[model samples]
Target chain A: MNYCSDCGATVSLKIPENDERMRFVCDTCGMIHYQNPKIVAGVLSVRGEQVLLCRRAIAPRYGLWTLPAGFMENGETTDQAAAREAHEEANATLRDLRLYTVISVPHVSHVHVIYRCELVSDDFAPGVESLETRLFHEHEIPWDELAFHTVRKTLECFFHDRKQGVFPVHNLAFTIALPT
Target chain B: MNYCSDCGATVSLKIPENDERMRFVCDTCGMIHYQNPKIVAGVLSVRGEQVLLCRRAIAPRYGLWTLPAGFMENGETTDQAAAREAHEEANATLRDLRLYTVISVPHVSHVHVIYRCELVSDDFAPGVESLETRLFHEHEIPWDELAFHTVRKTLECFFHDRKQGVFPVHNLAFTIALPT
Candidate 1:
């Protein structure tokens, strides 16, 4: 944001005469640059009685377990992104994926969309970003070793919904505590 | 991302010859840098027959209409983000914001999580990031003036679901054409 896209001039943060907050405005083109948060989408692929999980091959929370998920790419739909992530992380194809949960982590400026996907086939293995991939029954979930809070929340909601058989049509909320 | 967070030294993305993408050795702190896509959450506030829409005060699409939404902050859940956005943009409190749509726009690297929020109060004015705010009935919606593809799709889904009196429980695929 140091340089202006409209003109090759340096930009400055200023409060507009009509506005109270300061915005980065280009003196040359009078353009105001506003940056918004990004969205992350993934799938919770499930076999009859088991859920698919991936072991991370990269850092941040490497060696930890997680569902197949990734950032949404341009021009692709959410379902498409979910399917793509499933293919990339586990080489799994999904049939019906229901909107499971939407988790927001404002501190990191991201929104996570998790889908409950029915596994179309048993064909799966670790992909580029995954070290290992496996299926875990409800009782066998690696709860303590799960990589992110959103993943944990999604699983919790899924199990709760499965039990209630009511499968709430409404969205739920939870908080994630980051390690200080 | 190949750098030491502690000592500011360069790191490598390569895994040791024998390691199966499991171990990432940092040249400095020897710490692995793990990366993951973030989550974003927002609300689709509906007031009776009309839905709340905001004109973005910032770019990528400045002055374009959109739902009140933003990225999820750390420690906050998706539902929290949705409520927060609704308050922030429309100054409206929501009750029973059912999960409406989860759109993954891959090309832009974002997963849009939209909730169908019930407007609790009519006390709303334009927020800081909004050029202007207004409510539009289904037929009066400025579809062509929407800021993002995901927003458009979510609204369309809302109407479709409203017609059937059946809110979608699953994620659906949609393609958004780039503006000509």
Candidate 2:
């Protein structure tokens, strides 16, 4: 950060007294600007043996398929965020949502949480951020076009555990590949 | 946030196109600064039948008993943050850590994650952030002097699950009490 948001003063990167890490400290306001990892909450909507996937219309992986997800906003729980993302991206209503996976991607400074939710109905369409939306059975999933590793991992676990007839919450992490 | 950290430009609080919530937006830099909930990662270190607790030396609950926990910093996973908090608050070494509780405090926009850990040794003392450290059995716990609800909830879950002989990861949420 070049300037402190609190005071509009120039900031310096220095270790504060009694602290081990270097942080952005403001010269005028004496404010410490600390940045931290964010959470991306979404849903893995299930209807019978099918799951919902949306085609991204935005950049960074446009045209690729992804589950409905987005950066969580303040004042909402992870479950609320996941449901909201589902509505916004795929126009899907959810019911009986359960936390399924929590994955930390350190490379991107994000923790992704996906819920296993029952689709309220078979009716769904693409929202503004999606080019298209559809339900896919395991055989019809476009594995090669999945938008993120978190999505792939959650789906893989979901299908794997379905065969076992028991679904346990997954607490997992994966290192994101650094930019070339 | 008043000014853009990237360009030192005054920012406006407005809803961007296709976004439902208002955010701090810098017109000059086209930067949208969004605030989201943070994860407070900690450990519930158990030994035999006792659990570790630390008395806070910091404000916001000075001298109240709590488990070692703090905000998850950038570039670190939840596991690392939990371990670091243990070291920084109680000078405790922990092992065999397993994700135990995930509680969403939406009113505060924070998620508290606690892991079930085994204390490496009982030779820990109070760190700078802690006034005193001690091990507490179920009956010996200072129930009336707990620092936060998440700590109380985690401890309750731990003790309850101990009796059941099966400790499944808890995904729970509680409405945060509004600040007075």
Q: Of the candidates shown, which would achieve the greatest lDDT relative to the real structure?
A: 2
**Tens digits of lDDT, candidate 1, A18-105:** 6545777777778775545455779988899889999999887999999999876555666676788889888998997776766656
Q: All models: lDDT?
A: 0.74, 0.92
Which parts of model 2 are misplaced by more than 4 Å?
Answer: A176-180, B176-180
**With candidate 1 superimposed using the best TM-score fit, by how many Å does residue A170's alpha carbon deviate from the native?**
6.0
Predictions' DockQ, in order: 0.23, 0.79
* Candidate topping DockQ: 2
Worst 10 residues of 1 chain B by lDDT: B1-10
TM (chain A) per model: 0.87, 0.96
TM-score of chain A of 1: 0.87
RMSD of each: 6.9, 1.7
Per-residue lDDT of B1-180 in model 2, one digit per residue for the tens?
Answer: 889998888999999987778999997998998899999999999988899999999999999999999999988888888999999999999998898998899988899988899998988999999999999999999999999999999999999999999898888888846869
Q: For model 2 chain B, give the 10-residue run with minimal summed lDDT.
A: B170-179
- Cα DockQ of the candidate 1 complex: 0.23
User: Candidate 1 lDDT, tens digit per residue, B134-180?
Assistant: 88899999989998777888887888888999877546544456678
